[model samples]
Target: MTGRLKDKVVLITGAASGIGEHTARLFASEGALVVISDINAAAGERLARELGMHFIAADVSKEEEVERAVSSTVGWHGRLDCMVNNAGMVGVVGSILETGAEDWRRTLSVLLDSVFFGIKHAGRQMRELGGGGVILSLSSLAGLVGGVGPQVYSVAKAGVIALTRGAASELSAYGIRVNAVAPGLVMTPLVEEVYGGHDAALRGGAAKSPLGSAAMPQEIAASLCYLASDEARHVSAHTLVIDSGVSAAGAGAAPQFHHQPADFLGRLPEQYQ
Candidate 1:
């Protein structure tokens, strides 16, 4: 209710749940005319009703649907102020050896291609409106390093980073800012399911980082809000990392200290050992 984004028009993909859902709610509270887009019609409609925002059922992987969603938002609000390309999936879980072409393509389509579509269409609308807009995509710590996620998922996220930078370079003249948020371990319902339950997911996430905790959806949402609001008017082409120091520590560097044995330093000098 701070009104940081007052009167702004925002569209969030995959906003039926997780980080997208949280960001949509946060944006709405701050006075943005929010549009919730997701393939989950049931949840999307329910959330739209709850927040008094419009809901569009669009599978972001398809260019046509993404185009329609953006057009619909602009048609309703007369301009698109912000586009959050937040839809994502873990995709095939195995290494490249076990991954199929279909799975790889699907992952890229959802995670990478969708961002391009959003930026392209939103940028067009913003150019027409003559007011600068912002584009934010959800990236991952896995994109910046290895072994943090499945190979294909990491690859798609890496593409998002590159897309953000390239688009920012080209779109800055029109007053549009392109950026991304690279989150490490976030405790959402999707992650809870993957870890078998909420408690287990929290424990697992906490064990991996220097902060001894994982980020909540709200934490990531706050970063999204800042990037979308006027407070970040000068920010562009940046991938804000909100990973509880996990990425800085190189993903689980803290755990290495816990796994060492008392005699692990046997080769060291006697006094040091």
Candidate 2:
């Protein structure tokens, strides 16, 4: 009854709630010696205790904190097998004109700079350990298209994808695999809060997808597990899209197209339907 990540030393940032929390639980269930890192000390400690994993209270945006997180994990486990840079926030919600410089910088620091820090430290650890490790990042469907999210948030996520590609290219030389997951509308706690409630969030999320449903946090977590596991040994520098076909349909594109009967074309007014 060996698990997919048996004995693997995995660290997940923002492991206190939502997708990060779910991923921590799933990784532990799969036999990883999970280490949970988050800015929420109380929730992170509680979850670590619940799952018998180590907890590190570190804001992923801080390079020093991020470096320490990786170092601490490696110190405890003797090697770092995987690092999931899942910490993020729905940055200031507004148009480009409405977004201030502070909001933009903070959003990028969390969503983009944090990944860079994680890759920098984790990549070094893996290389020092004699090669081989996985780095998974949380991108979004908004990163792939415009008008789906706040300007700052979208820009940050798009930067994550580009970072993933660039890091993967360089890290491959050291047996490290870098990849990202772009989820569409996942009904996490933050999302529910924004939409007012679970029902509203689900309804809104499902409306944007071709599947008629929003993704659960667990669904996105599952994708993380796959990327972290040995099954993805050959897969690198790839951003897996787990949007339930939303991206394929161009996010919010009309699901149905109108068709006119052959005889009805001329009956319609010019420039009108």
Number of the top lDDT candidate: 1
Off by over 4 Å in 1: 252-273
Clashing pairs in 2: none
Residue-wise C-alpha lDDT for candidate 1, range 1-273, written one tens digit per residue? 999999999999999999999999999999999999998889999999999999999888889999999999999999999999998776555646556687667668888998999999989999999999999999998888777776777899999999999999999999999999999989988788768899999998988779888779999999999999989999999999887777667763332222323222233223222
Model 2 TM-score on a 0 to 1 scale: 0.91
Q: lDDT tens digits, residues 1-273, model 2?
A: 259999999999999999999999999999999999998899999999999889999988889999999999999989999999999887555546545676567678888899999999999999999859999999998899776776677888999999999999999999999999999889999889768899999998888778888889999999999999999999999999888886667754321111211222233223211
Query: Candidates' lDDT values, in order?
Result: 0.86, 0.86
User: Cα lDDT for residue 172, model 2?
Assistant: 95
Candidates' TM-scores? Answer: 0.91, 0.91
Pick out the ten consecutive residues of candidate 2 with the lowest summed lDDT. 254-263
Clashing pairs in 1: none
